[model samples]
Target: MTSISMAGTGSGLVLTASWQDTVPATLTVRAPGQGDGATPERPLVEVLTSRHGRDWAGPRYVATSVGQRLRYRSHELTSSGSWQTLSLTQTDAVTGLDVTSYLSIHDEHLAVRSWTSLYNNASEPVTLHAVSSLMFGDFGAADIDQMYLLRGRSDWLAEGRWSRERLRDAGLPDLTTPGRPFRTRGCIEASSLSSWPTAQELPTAVIGDDSTGTHWSFQIEHNGGWLWQVGEVPDGLYLALFGPTDEHHGWQLELLPGATFESVPVSLAIEGDGTLDAITGFRRASRAPGGGPGLPVVFNDYMNTVMGDPSADVLHPLIDAAADSGAEYFVIDAGWYADNGDWWDAVGEWQPSTRRFPGGIGEVLEHIRRRGMVPGLWLEPEVVGTNSPMALKLPDAAFLQRGGERVTEHGRYHLDFSSVQAVDHLNEVVDRLVNDLGVGYFKFDYNIRAGVGSDSVAASAGHGLLRHNLAYLAWIDSLRQRHPQLMLENCASGGMRQDFATVSRFDLQSTSDQEDLYAYAPIAASAPMLILPEQAANWAYPQPDMTDDAIAFTLCTAILGRLYLSGWLDKLSDDQRLMVAAAVRAHRELRDSIPHCLPFWPTGLPRWTDQWISLGLRDVGGDALYLTVWRRDTEPGQVDLTLPPAPDGMRWDYPSAVFPVESPLRIEGEPSGGTLRIVDVRGSHAARVVKLRSVPVE
Candidate 1:
């Protein structure tokens, strides 16, 4: 057997490729310092093909010399700034087809972003049945095994549901195969074949070994149809990440001679610390370059606030109240374009309702500006209602279609940005909103899903959707280019489309549309696991009737991330308003530092009904730690929580509180001991944000 070795210094990973004249090409990866010079048993980048009728290996697999004639070609290494890339090519001896895999790694982030390309060298066209965009080799021991798979699920209101399952319990067992060809492959896949890409499940996963604290995570960076899976093979475990496939989404690509087909992009990370360690690496890789307009405190008038019914009369008071409560952006979300109440079905024309705003929509927008807050408007640019004029006026090619028929879902037709007419329409709308209205921010929302996808001008439905997805990303880039100072918030009926593809470009992401703050605690607490804290815009809508504890609970959820404020601030009592102001003030003080912090959850993943949830953002240098703890209806007035070991001389101080008026809240233990007893937490549904700083040992 021959071995080809490649190293990615920036990402601290080494790749080892092994193959023989009659064996499959296998790839094994290891953290630079891991193992005692031992090669990993399984290969992550498995190559499979339909040419040999070996379709039972469950899609992609390690290219075996016996099944398919694939051999390692050559590799190229390059570096620019902190990013390094290693590209390896494999050639099919029979067909002379070349497949190149590119892995890009960053110096500071422990993640690797990868994509693959297939080039047909033969004179005849080659049809590809499946291709893996990204993969991982096994990183766990086989003998003393206790590993689990972590998956993320999302929905309309309650998003960010993460669950863990033992690999063996999930029908994936570690077997002893010495000289047997084992086809016992069990795969766990999460696919989003719709416009609401993240509506059902998040394209994020984690596999961890409980005995060794080793974890690996991978997230697909596609806006449309995507698939990521964890499969157990006789050698060990393997992960395959890709876009739509022929078997799952009717996707196939025919590459003519010398033509190349590029696969989707995926980011992966492996660490020896915990699942959170892998998450931290992902967050680092996803950090937006050139930075963002500092995380602003926004007050959005939706979700238990205005509920999408906004008017000049209704928003004027809220704008003033938002500005007074220290909100920097007051976003008028949804229902602004309809002259009638049933606006959902008539949403094509992006025009302000004269009936609702007699003085013109610009009047309300100006009112927001006069209140010293940036004006943001809600827009769903990817879909047009079936009853809208655009549905009849625009060309059929401008919308997603299946077999020449328009694809409609939830009373809307998905826009095909690949169509020039669709792109022009979106540009016109955005120009009118930004140039004419002087809107500095936009709450871009998507509310529908185009199932499977369109088949127009493509080999299959999945390929058609993939084309539109690329076009959609280009459109977003164009919008940013036109409006350089624009701050965009991505929402899909509230985070149903929350993936790195959209989240990486937008300034903020609405964590959820959940109105009940108590139920939203888990979502907010777990959001940092998927997105950076600076971009996680959790809602803190404190209604007038909510108890002080409840109001504080909601406010606490927002402060840890971006403070997305709502509710009727003008209707609140004097004390309640002060409390809101305090939360905003606290966020403002910490906003500048949030981008430089890494998140850690002391209580692991939060459950929907978990009595107490803790989220901590620790500075990279161990200078300080900002912690948010929420105590719900559990019996224990005080919860003893174990935290990561703090610096030698760190002391937590009670900065502020929103409830109990006199003696609101305080911490009763030291973090230096690695355990904190949050005492005097008071009533149920209460929360507090504490700041811990390193002091001289005394």
Candidate 2:
């Protein structure tokens, strides 16, 4: 940003810079000027094609339009401080536009900036009647839709198979999913939230010259603020939505000068670094609210080399392994019971396959408990297999209908969490595990997409999809409320729907069934790392064509993440088990440090090449610092050390091996710190952990 200025008063763009409680608040713009360009204080500029006026039930109409006209009447609720508007100016360093906008929290003061060559158009404002006309449906919304209602709709629609995009231009193409019902949640590509016109839903008009088009914007109230803006470029495009939760006024603008012009500021939320800083505001911190370390490490059994009837014999190794590694939780994964091509059907039966576990589920829990580890069980509460008991009882009409027929994505069906019966189903399953079976932790899995709704109730709600999503969340809420200390996981076919909402709901998350090998990037980039560490990545004995130590090193690296482990712990060699113990010990050591000091930036983590110097600080006041330099078996380059800030009067050393102070070490740009020389740290070399000696602070 450059050359920012402020203003206070009526009629136009408003920007304000203030100090609140000693916190420096920079310029904030709430409204903008006309025609696609930024002026001082205004954060948005707009462009429009044509506009029309229509009278609805309560308001006059003023809609900037390309194909359809949207009208909304201005309801001025208050005007006391209306004239006390604030204005400011902003010049983007990158764009170099002279941008100006406004800021106001008052009510009943707004105008519609319209751009139109609209041919002798009357100066009438547009009125919106969205509340009067509404559309309700059971099937999920089509991107091509315009209006929606929350009532007068009832029917369970099956899970949808496609998400289609509307194409208006001659050469434009419809984004199609064809016959593909969403497969695994982890695998689905995000569908477009864009369409032809979430733009002209407001008032804006400008006279368009054949040489150029008009630009404009909608001053929308969103997320408890009036300063939200939707910018429309000269090409007639803008996309932003308000949640209807703020009491404020706003307006849109358009410019139609002789030569259609384009020079203005827009309220986008990214810096040139290609960083999505806006995503930070949406992020919720990961440490569970009021949570303590109840279970440090959890081990998974049954998935690795032990998938027969899943018996005490199979668990013997797991128990001894847990005892040796001191893992505090043991989870018995799928296939422990009799599964006959039916995931949901046999699920509710909730009994151990007698053939494998002659001792029974309770007995198995006793074994884990005796070993001082909490026992965990896995369940998919949202799914009801075709052969499941519940599916046999409910009719297809009870579910959602789509295009007129019941929708079914995969063979597994989605449970209508919106129904009371569904709630009972969930509670029943929980009761079986927590109350009867004595399971302390639960892994909740939803391997299917949400389009399934055969429940009679969800059929009529205008906001069926939204409601359903809320209902699922509500059920989780209810469970949490009741079992205040439940450590449950929300796994959706391997890390899908791993958003803030889900993360906040579930105590832990099952990142993926794909536990290792390529788990790092997706979880780091797509999934939020702050929520999940202690993830499930384990060291295993090297399979054929693989070395045992390689698996051991991989497991040690994985232990650094926030995930659980899924492997046959019993099958590990003594050396591998020792490595596991060492990794766990490291995790235990770093558990209590605050986020900023001990936290890691997943994107900046060292690559597998291993010859990179990674840094971590214990505290700002402490002289002690930690850095890891390891060479991957792949790369053979010598690792260079770029020391972070450290105290001058201290000695630094590698793990158990201190490097001697070296002369002629470049210190020009280096922050004051003890210097040392590190030779080649690659080619099957052991990793070195360096700690700086303490220094006194004045």
Candidate 3:
């Protein structure tokens, strides 16, 4: 028996998934009003499992699961405002073990969040090999030529590097080839059981067809041990999302009778248009819930300026300057916890260094409070320095261990949040910092990865890491619950721990640790590809001696997102100070519209060394738009930006003083929309933020 149901997502998309006794179960999405009423034949969701007594499939670890052989049991549907959930249950014909998949959709963004659960319905215990958080059916037309896959790559300094590839060019053999059964090949994955999850790659991808404006984007929401795959199948391509699959990460689970295991969560967005639509859909769907503090301008003393060395004499002037410059939160990042100059290995104590502070850190905190800025501190909670007393005092279970030996990386031991002692220790540290010290913001930093993870008490190293990740999220939730006013920023040595799982919980995300303002341009321009603009805390660390063009360039980098000011603010000349202040004032004017606007790039994704780049945010109601353009080199520094169709005579304003243009400007109207012929009017390494207002056409 089989059943099919369709629901409109209110955003021009229709989601449909079906299950049948003879056919495999799957979920698919399509643009409504275009396709016939008949249900699409491909299922996007795939599930694979292993039973002790059954015949083996392909690989003990990576065998793909097709739902055709399973027995369809039942399903349920529930709805709330703009959101709906579809839960389906299927059982293995031979073992009676059941798998239930939950697919939740929100109409506001035409997006879906999915996860799976394994239930031991049988009388005996069952060992499971794998469960997927999400699996996607191929989108776009039958011909693969129009299909392209988008992937984001990241590193310590070079972050948010995105590239596009044609699906057929991926060289996957055609599944429709005669007598050739399709074989899945080569998967692009980003896995981090280690501390730096985004160090190598971002857990996000997009599939789009150029010929047809259809696109699909998905992101895995796990802080540790995540894997997503794109492979070719018989009818179309498929995407598989899981956390630490057994083949790569050595993960497995045992479910005793009546026991259950829930897979990690994944979110997917379906848009009827281009890459920008998909990206905007993701941002709207995965944003942090309301009740947190508003995103404000922050000043940190660690990037390119202070470099973590802070004392009373060093910080007092900076705090005064930051407060004067309109920074709302002043964060003293790193090196405040230890008196010793070499403070990396002396962490875990989290005590303010009296030697560094001299008059005590509280004096500085009081000064910041008096200056009308919130006080923030840097903390690395997941590690205990080898030299710290807690390393020796805590039980073996408190720290990550392989067999009986504790795992050490980069002069620190990874703390296992699954252990009560570890959680309690971190809780105490946070409570003390938030309560006793009157701290309102925290910049949480993670510096190292634990490699494959600890093998303490779990089925596998991957299993142990998964347990710890969940526990860590739970701890963070509890902290937020205890202190609802506290704002937490997630950083793994800067922008490495980026994912929806962490992004949804925290208030802000550090975009990068790159100190060079010139080199940081592409990173800031490309940030909206992965993070919400309001939550992307990009650093605007303009040095005192930098040229006006250079200063404007760096300030523009931070203004689009959460402005993170650093560098020597007190030493800036009057002219330089005015430029910085103008950037901040511009950001404040643009901040309110940021939460409701959708991001789009006029010239597409920025290259690492692109001479010209543009990022645009337009309101959904078509009333206004904010565009930032950066010119890196002295070459052609000109771009003709064509905005989405807007009312005629839209007002355009630019601050020529800050963003001096060397070229003449020409404005024209085209069939596509209004065109800004912004000619050679800017110095090299300069930028401008243009505000466009739409007035009713008379």
Which pairs clash in model 1?
24-64, 44-136, 46-61, 47-61
lDDT of 2 by residue, 1-698 (tens): 22332332432333334322221123333333322233222112221222322221112111212112221111111223333323333222211222222332322222221111111122332221111000001111112222111001001111011111222221122333568542111110111111100111211111111112111112121101111222222222223222211111111223222212211111211111212222221122222352225336666663334432456776876777776776777777665655332343445445556655666768878988988988887777766665556676665533444444544556666565666766776787787778787787777766556442233443222223334555677787788777766677666554444434455566565544443332332232222222333332322222223344444433433343443554555666676666566656665554333122332221133333323323233433444454433333444444345444344544343332211112111112222343444454234523333344454433
Q: What lDDT score belongs to each candidate, Candidate 1 first?
A: 0.76, 0.38, 0.75
lDDT of candidate 1 at residue 61, scale 0 to 100 = 47
Please provide TM-scores, in order, for all candidate models, with all chains considered together: 0.93, 0.57, 0.93
RMSD to the hidden true structure, all candidates:
2.8, 15.8, 3.0
Q: Pick the candidate with the highest lDDT.
A: 1
Q: What's the distance in Å from true for residue 70, model 1?
A: 2.1
RMSD of 2: 15.8
State the lDDT of candidate 3 residue by residue for 1-698, as single tens digits.
36655464566656666777676576766656446344434443344545442132443222344344555678888888777888888777655568788988776666778898878888877666567787776364445667788888898889999888887675544446577675554444455545455677778878777786677788888888777777665565667788766666677777788998899988787765654665466566656563364668899999988887888899999999898888999999999988867987778979999998988899999999999999999999999988888888888899888988888988999999999999999989998998899999999988878777778888678788888888988988888788888878888877888877787788888988998887887888888877787888999987888987788778888877889899899999888887777778778866877877778877788888888788877777657777778777765446777666674555433222223232122223332345565555533567776667665454
**What 10-residue stretch in candidate 3 is worst by lDDT?**
654-663
Compose the digit string of candidate 1's lDDT tens values, residues 1-698.
Answer: 87765565555676666666554456666675567344544433444445543435444444423124556777778878777787877777665578787877766656678888888888987667667787666564632258788888888787888888887776566565778677564566678756677788788888878877767788888888778777676556667787777776777777789898888888888765654565565565655552246888889998797897888888888999999999888898999998867989779878889988999999998988888888888999989999998888899989989989998988888988889999999899989988999888888888887777778877777778888888888888888877888888898888888888878888899988898888888899889777888889999998899988788888888887889999999899998998889888878887888877877877777877778788878776557777788777645477766665556565544333333233344567556666676764445567788776766666
